[model samples]
Target: GNATMGSGVDKHALERSSYEVLTGAADIRDAITKAEQAGYDLLPANADLTAAEVELLQMPQRERRLREALNSINGRYDYILIDCPPSLNMLTLNALVAAQSVIIPMQCEYYALEGLTALVSTIEDVRDNLNPFLKIEGLLRTMYDPRNRLAGDVTAQLSKHFGDKLYRTVIPRNIRLAEAPSHGQPALVYDKASRGAKAYLALAGEMLRREEMASAGA
Candidate 1:
């Protein structure tokens, strides 16, 4: 997660958090924890991270802090997913600079569309000025309800605009998914039979398929 926002539930305790890594107070490796249940290593964040946003402004090469940190552990993982805060800020810029591609997840709503426009513009600005290789990997429609008329309309609009860049798998609104985070577990681990769990599994399959097709074409 980004340094400025906390995920509410604590995952692990660290000698040095993302805040320390960003400020050069600690090594990035010190902040990483192995989350066995979730099946991935995590760089957990906490309340201390809230101060990093303001402190980063005075630091040299501020926007590249995250990228520089990750460079030390390059090729150690298949993917490095940074969960950014809702609003754009210095932390968001660091994430943008660090990432090669962005998977944009949004609810199918009018306000979300407005936010997408701003986000796309921000991505473009970052690509031009900061990270030239940055690109939109795909757009994910989350918490989707097939029965909702507004959702269907917005989905149509997204399909028209994004074409194949919009993912075929839409994450349905499911209670189990919402409750799993509170229990400090993923939906698949909490209830694999749940709609949310199956949807995510399907999404992963779709992503793999696309990757294979891209590789073959290349």
Candidate 2:
């Protein structure tokens, strides 16, 4: 079983409980608990982690705090995913340092493309200095509105540069996608037949297939 994670994922308009989860706080070095009936284990995050910036600034190997914390429990999972915040920060740096690869889910917007450029550069810098094995696993098109001409143009630009690194699965803009989180459920669990759910399923399949192909090639 791959024990995947997506860290630093917060909502724009958080419910009271949601706000508490990120700012609710937990010990970083060893606070592992399973979330709900999701079967997957959860790692707690706290608002105080933001203060880790200054608190850890004077500490040695500050960039590796997260990596070290996770290493203690590395034997528990086959895979781990870290969903970082939008901006580059110590927390994000820790995630990149710990990760072997990254899957970037991007909205097809002009601004998003600019974000990608900066993110990619950061990845390269991290790969060269902090984590030599870091790789961009894939770029996913998200919130795709096929009717939008700008979305299409941005995607085409992305494909031109990323080529096979761009995933074939495009997650369309859907109400179900927005609603599932509010109900505290995954789209697949909430509405298995919904377009949002199906797109995500396809994305998972594509990722698995790529993994298989890479393993075979290796």
Q: Pick the candidate with the highest lDDT.
A: 1
Model 2 C-alpha lDDT per residue in residues 35-154, reported as the tens digit of each score: 543556556444544566666666678788777766666777887767577778877888899999999989988888889999999999999999999999999999999999998898
Q: Worst ten-residue run, lDDT, model 1? A: 2-11
Question: Which parts of model 1 have CA positions greater than 4 angstroms off?
Answer: 1-12
lDDT of 1 by residue, 1-218 (tens): 32211233363455667889999998888878766676777787877777999999999999999999999999999888898888899999999999999999999999999999999999999999999999999999999999999999999999998899999999999999888777767677888999999999999999899889999999
lDDT of 2 at 50: 58
lDDT of each: 0.87, 0.73
On TM-score, the candidate that comes out on top is 1
Pairs with backbone N, CA or C atoms under 3 Å apart (clashes), candidate 1: none
Report the C-alpha displacement of residue 119, candidate 1, in angstroms.
0.3
- TM of each candidate vs. truth: 0.94, 0.84
